[model samples]
Target: MSSPKSGGAGWLVLLALLVLVLAVASVLVGASDVSMLALLGIGGAPADPMASQLLFASRVPRTVALILSGMAMAVAGMIMQMLARNRFVEPSTAGTVESASLGVLAVALFAPELPLFGKMVVSAGFALAGSLLFLAILRRIPQRSSLIVPLVGLVLGGVISAVTTFFAHRHDMLQSLHAWSTGDFSAVLRGRYELLWIGFGLTLLAWHTAHRFTVAGMGRDFSANLGLRHGRMVALGLLIVATVTAVVVVTSGMVPFLGLIVPNLVSLMLGDNVRRAVPWVGLLGAAFVLACDIAGRLLLHPYEVPIGTVVGIVGSALFLFLLLRTRARVG
Candidate 1:
């Protein structure tokens, strides 16, 4: 009999290969005429100058951003679920994304020419505060049911979003705010998406500390009994989540239902073992975004539908299915 570990490794290899294929497809499917043959210079056909231009300047960067942001959000979400001890909680739902968006809006207003790194710092600070606020609210609640927890997060997110919108409208930055809040990859260019690399690095840190996060997920008392610094671990997890949230929002805007649904779906497949599931989460997340992006490109023909809308439609439906299924399991 094969060990589950070995079996999982096999599946992991397969998933990685699948994600590679999806990445190639992402590079090929675009408004421009970039094709596999052109990329390969196959059949002695010279690469079209336009194809090369589109491939390097646009498609490659966009695809890289998608993978990095996808992995970051999914891994960050998993860390969050572990810390919250709730499957449904993620950065967006917990008000972290809104806070980061607010931070971006602040930068746009106060420091219009702030470097990307500077924006990341400010946004991360706000996202960390939002995450802490959510955790504080969770502590005060007497009932911490799975459904109830996410509902509270949703409420908190709504409040933050409302404030952000109000300030944005007042300052005439609503259009820019919308661009920052909606996950659209159309504008991603080579230099623009480097911020997501920082997010991806933080994601690697989360993977390195996965076991600690697993312990942190079991509540303070349990983690304390195991000789873990529960509070510190929680802080680290929140920092990782916040930084990644800021990075993605700053680079490509908020991709809703991504952090919430990807981790939940991965949990169903791999159980709650953060260490083991981290790679799978990243791979699945990239594939999820790639597929959605491809569909968005095709759905509207040359026009493109925005990855956020496509993922929102699909992820929300899956979320509802998971909710009902979990409810059934509980019943």
Candidate 2:
């Protein structure tokens, strides 16, 4: 049998390959027949001008958004899990998504003409506040049981989501809220997805802080004993998670399971060395989201299923399995 270290390296390589394949497949699978052969110069120019236009204008942006958003959300999930010391905690569960949604709605209602960048800033601020609130609640809770943290987060998220919904209905912007909350990359065009690149930067920041986050995960007393500033690390980790979640929710809507499922899956395969696991988390995140986006594009053919819906289905199933397995172990 391969040693665990070698196995992890092998898995990382496999995940990188899969991400590359899926990226190409995503670029090639759109409605217009953009000949990959032509793009590669293996054949004559694309027969239709629209083909090149579609490829560069729409397909490229959408694919880039997928990769960036996927990696960002996965990394965010990893950070949240580490900080909370709970496998099931994610942005959606922790109220960050709902908080961002509320921010977007607030922008639309009060300053309908606000630029997209302005909207993103507002949303990110709200997400940071909501995440801090979740963290505060976690601090008060006894950590005797791992599941209680996520359960509390879920309840908090639900309450926030309900409040957003109520205000959206009152303001007669429920449809707009729904559209922004649903994750779909079909509408991503050249300029619309540039915000997601900010997410890419945040993911890199997470990588730099990975060691601090891992130490912070060992509980406050332990981290403090090791001469680490536990509170500062936790604050930084939550900021990364909130910012990433806000950008993604603003750009592509709430991709529910990408964050929650990918990091946990990576942790199961590889051990909890955050520095080492970050790369695998990022690669698997990109591959998983790309795969879901491709499936969404093809599943209905002429009409596309939203990427959020596709991921929600798969993520929910995997989540259930994880819960059951955890329960069995506990029992």
RMSD values, in order shown: 1.9, 2.1
Q: Give me the runs in candidate 1 sitting further than 4 Å from their true place.
A: 1-7, 36-47
> What is the lDDT for 137 in model 1?
98
TM-score, candidate 2, is: 0.94
**Cα deviation of 267, candidate 1, in Å:** 1.8
lDDT of 1 at 165: 96
lDDT of 1 by residue, 1-331 (tens): 4343443687888888988999999988876788867766788988677788888999999999999999999999888888888888888778899999989888888998999999999999999999999999999999677888888988999999999999999998889988998899999998999989888889889889999899888888999999999999989999999999999998888898898898777777777677888888888999999999999999988999989889889988987888788889999
Cα error, residue 296 of model 2, in Å, equals: 0.7
Model 1, position 302: C-alpha lDDT score: 91
Question: Judged by lDDT, which candidate is best?
Answer: 1
Alpha-carbon lDDT, every model: 0.88, 0.87
Q: Which stretches of candidate 2 lie over 4 Å from their true place?
A: 1-10, 37-46
| Model 2, position 145: C-alpha lDDT score | 78
